[model samples]
Each structure stands twice: as C-alpha cells, then as structure tokens.
Target: MSRYVVSFMKDVLGGNGRQIEVCQKTLEIDASSEGEATELAKQKFCKVEHLCEWSLHADRIQIKSADFTS
Candidate 1:
C-alpha cells in the first residue's frame, strides 16, 4: 500500500475571466493492485465536478485506508 497525490485542473467558477484553477489532494491507497488504488481514489474524491478531473501523480507515505476521508 502507498499514498498518491491527485492534482486537478478546471475552470474557475464565479470568475469574470476564463481562468483555470489547479487543486491537489492526497489519497492513501493499497498498491497491491492498480484497480484498487484507482477505485479508492475515485470513491474518495470523485463526488465533486472539479475533483473528477484529477490525475494521480507520485505516490506518498502510506496511511491506513478509510471508508471516507474528507
């Protein structure tokens, strides 16, 4: 198991100009399989429209998996 950082880039809401904002979040995942990690990340952060555009970067230090971490 390992941790990963998902970075998001999306259009900024309530802005006068057409600008994009970048956001980042970290997820601790079981690297035992790629599917597990992907699923875990989606479940945790995919609820929001902006976060759904996130892409995983480097893995981080491991932490215990949770049902939800918000």
Candidate 2:
C-alpha cells in the first residue's frame, strides 16, 4: 500500500466561465491505487461528517501520492 493524499474541493465559477478549485479538506490514506484511495477517503469523510453523500460536502475530489521524507 502507498500513502495518498485525498482532497475535498469546492469549485467556484467566476466571470467568463472561469472555474477555480478550493480545497476544503484533506486526508492521508493507505491504499493500493489512486482510485481506491479516493473511494476510501470519501467513505471516511462522509462517515466522520455524518453525511450520506460525499458530494454534499464538496464539489469534487482529488488524490495524489504522498511524498514523505524520514
């Protein structure tokens, strides 16, 4: 398993069809793949926030491999 960072993002639309992604929350997870990490993060987030859907809290999700130096 690899460490991944999952982010819950909120999107804002501006003038002329401009879009911006604002990160609302981030989670560190251990998963075999990026897709798995995203799924796990969403489930965990929803459970912790007492929501039935992950979309209720954020517009989208982003995941990346976490780089750590020891």
Candidate 2 lDDT at 40 equals 95
Q: Clash totals for all models, in order?
A: 1, 0
Instruction: Give residue 63's error in model 1 in angstroms.
Output: 16
lDDT of each: 0.48, 0.90
Stretches of candidate 1 exceeding 4 Å from the true structure: 13-16, 46-70
- Distance (Å) between predicted and true CA of 58, model 1? 19
Top candidate, metric TM-score: 2
Alpha-carbon deviation at 21 in model 2, angstroms: 3.3
Q: In candidate 1, how many Å is residue 69 off? A: 27
Best by lDDT: 2
Error of 2 at 31 (Å): 0.4
**Candidates' TM-scores?**
0.38, 0.78
